[model samples]
Target: MAAPKEIPLDEIQWHDPFEIQRIGGLHSNTVLFYFASSPFFDGTSNNAIVYNQAVHNENMNHLIHTREAFEGRLREMTGLEFMVAQEPAESGPGMGTGVWVIHKQTRRKREPKDEIIVHAAYYLVGDHIYMAPSFSDIVNHTMITITEKLSKCFAIADKARTWSPSTGHGYNTASATTSAKAHALESKGTTPMPNTQESSTSEAKKPTRSAVDSRLAEHSFMIHMQYGGEYMDENPITGKPGEFHLSSTGRKDKMPTLALPSLNTTMVSSSLTQPDKKDAKAGEKTPKTPTGMSKIKRKKSKAGATPTSA
Candidate 1:
């Protein structure tokens, strides 16, 4: 595959790779939009993007210290001092609304020859307060072109969606008119209601065994073992096997009495009662031939005399 060539700044539509993401909030919703080819793109980088975050709240601090916030972040990253200058100007719809223009310049600690300048605009459109900040090495005309495109893209949508006349922070009658129109359309059943009950039921029907098994045992089953002559079922909860014991009624036996075979005891008792084999053999008397005579000759003489004596 071939690499994608960079687009020239003037010829660029300034809208490629523009993406938006919803930033969650407890009290208000915020939408952030990024223009990929903005002056903020430092060339030869991935995810080199810049943002304009639109906060949907009336009392938001949109104009205050926006320059300082950008400088503080740059100072933290580069460890250098930044000089800031602010200018007030009219914005939106033939310069009817007011806005703050912030300009900041700084140099990195290691790069003595290099300088960075950031330009940010803070303005409100309808119910949303927008903070559009960008930093780059581009000329002022390019910066203005990029900011204008971004402002126009979000301003129209913000006026249509989040702005309401009931908010009482009206920037223009068009915002109020759009708010009323959206409310009337909604009341006329243009939007569908959420199926909250069905969603909750489905969520509840999800198996809770995985949660229980994580805390308890992953695999639950019966464990049976034979101890002595009685079969014992192990308790899965306490993981302890049962022993032979009486029932709570005291009359009935819960388990049979455990008994060992008597072969060992019988062998021990018989050994204690029987006579010693060595002592019995020593007590037995045995007839012996004279040391000088042969046993064979004595046996022959006895057999020959036995016939005459009989």
Candidate 2:
């Protein structure tokens, strides 16, 4: 067999992973391709394309929606059968992930089987969406290694990413994004980065209250009167009966107690013990009809007539 001709090192072309490209039609607005890293370091005859997009679009705003559109596009463009390698999983709160794999066989039957696999993933960070796509020969280490790295990189980058609702394109330079976030927290009166020293000093300076002070704190009461509005202090007595208190705002005055006439115990006792004069006058009409009664009456008449007859 003839020795294969060696290609010069200078002729070798390197793929640029940090290329930025703008794509349209998946969403109403354009999707920004922020960064793409390829895993094809060896010079091979496999035609593979790997890229990443930090995207913002109302239609493709979430991880689920983005995955659908992305996978649909890949199938339509590549005309290959693709399977869901990994379903959308939450890497963190308000974060999701998805991965899809594709296999393509060589066109000719006599030629050795050349399998190509395409891997893609997406992330929903804040209101922004990020997607990663990799294309490589379905060799064990090439496609698998790249896909794992891609997911890890996306998860790590989630913390630094932010989205703005007002602007369709929420992405900004690193320095600008940080400054804008800091300004926003300040305006909203939120402590994005709390000061431990100030918090400790304030806590230390607070004096410990006594038990008596704590007990008396809830002693205050509001006094309400029938005729007037309520007041915080106790009600005071006014001079005259049925009169409002001088200090009282508008409350009704207290009613006065009634005094009874004094009673004479001696006069009450004589009146109860004395006999009526009407009964004594009726005694003269009987005239001592019975014997015993007549004797007694005669003796009384004689004594009254004169002492000489005795």
lDDT of 1: 0.41
Error of 1 at 115 (Å): 6.9
Give the alpha carbon lDDT tens digit for every residue of 273-305 in model 1: 666666667666543433444567433466446
TM-score of each: 0.20, 0.16
Per-residue alpha-carbon lDDT of candidate 2 for residues 1-310, written as tens digits (9 for 90 to 100): 9999985322333333223232322221212122112221222212122112213444433422354555444433332333334434545676754322222222222325434444344432322333333333336557789999999988867644544333322334778878988986564447365686998799788754432344343333112235346445566656787875657557677899889865466545655655666765654543323332234334344545654553
Each candidate: what lDDT? Answer: 0.41, 0.41
Clashing pairs in 1: none
Question: Relative to the unseen true structure, what is the C-alpha lDDT of residue 301 in candidate 1, on a scale of 0 to 100?
Answer: 60
State each model's C-alpha RMSD to the native.
30.7, 27.3
lDDT at residue 112 of model 1 (Cα atoms): 46
Off by over 4 Å in 2: 1-36, 40-65, 79-84, 92-310
